[model samples]
Target: MQNAVLAKVPYGEEGCAEQHDSDLTAVIIDDCRPDLSLQRFALQANGRFKEIVEFNSPVRALEAFATKSLAADLILVDFRMPWMTGPEFILAYERLAASYKPTPHIVLLSAMPGAELKAYEINSRLLLAVCPKPVSLDTIETIVGKIQPDQ
Candidate 1:
């Protein structure tokens, strides 16, 4: 369910989606529904992305990647998900052909502490960052700041 408080809040101009200037496609993968809704809202409010796609499972998200359906510019995935961890997903994603990989930034969101999180650090090429659970608007800004213009 979308947060009632956030529903009342307005974004940049009129509210909600306003055809973000960046025109970037952002994909969010999370097993939790409420968290997914909030993440979508945060990205919408940032006004940097054109489209936001949600996946409840990393496995389903991987399927999208394999089928060339998801051409994401920014990806936000939960680290601890059933079937595939975010790092594992990144590793599998890296196996796709060069033409299949369009995403420039991939963020892993986790509630796991530093030590445990370090164990999953595998790819620096595709995985751009690691963020905390319940991603806030500030976190969204920081992630967007990392995205370069050329990308």
Candidate 2:
């Protein structure tokens, strides 16, 4: 149950150029601590997200969303969890976002072979993309690239 925020600092010449690029906020919800850590590490390594928040419980993530404290440019959720499944979380998240102006991009991560495609079919606009479990850096980069900065 480790909840933490990882703020990436811009560094080096390349980092300096992208310092003012975009302030992308990302939220990650995964029941497995190790998996969450791995996702966070990959995102940090990519250096695209300005702020990354991690939650080990989907329920807690929903609670934060209810309180309007879980706003993000992109959201990464695990497919299966104790309190809610990925689809259930997406449903709740869409309901919450309906009242807001701009909706955040949602990405589902699962070990299921066709989970990503199924999720896209469920909610094409709300869901940006899906990545396989044990997420690879390339997969993450592809997803991140698809997300446009919040305007």
Candidate 3:
């Protein structure tokens, strides 16, 4: 999976200059494979992606980050997991990502209502938005395409 991710992107190294048109790298962390697949499809349909990496476990994803085996322009995280909740992952990422010159933007995905999800006490400049689960093409285009109004 790692090899595939690295190979699929046009640019090989981080901060490479081959970026254009569709150069965004996104990391998706979700325990549900179906959700991951659907989200991946939606993101691909958005046409702004260079690479997309998926992790089923926060522990493993953190390990990848610690080892510098991962780099991303955006990260989409599910709010509930057996190992670590979305807020916990965001906090851990905050601690681990201090050295990153341009840390990845994050979007939290939850089954909860938007209002309820927004109430999560996540303090990070990296957080862009909290989106509802079962990602769709509209969700990808509207929320992700702009990636603005950073929260």
Candidate that scores best on TM-score: 1
Worst 10 contiguous positions by lDDT, candidate 3: 2-11
Per residue, candidate 2 scores C-alpha lDDT tens digits across 1-151 of 2443333332332322233366777788888878887888777767777777877777778788888866788888998888888878998888878876456888888887784446445564678877789988888889888877753
- Per-candidate TM-score against the hidden true structure: 0.82, 0.81, 0.80
lDDT string for model 3 (1-151, tens) is 4312222333344433333475577888888878987777777666677787888887778888888878777888999987899889999998989888456888888998878776778888778888888987888777665653222
Which lDDT value does model 2 have at 39? 82
RMSD of each: 5.2, 4.0, 5.7
Q: At residue 9, give the lDDT of candidate 3.
A: 34
Clashes of 1: 0
- What's the TM for model 2? 0.81
lDDT of 1 at 148: 71
Which residues of candidate 3, in runs, are more than 4 Å off? 1-20, 148-151
CA error at residue 49 for candidate 2, angstroms:
1.1
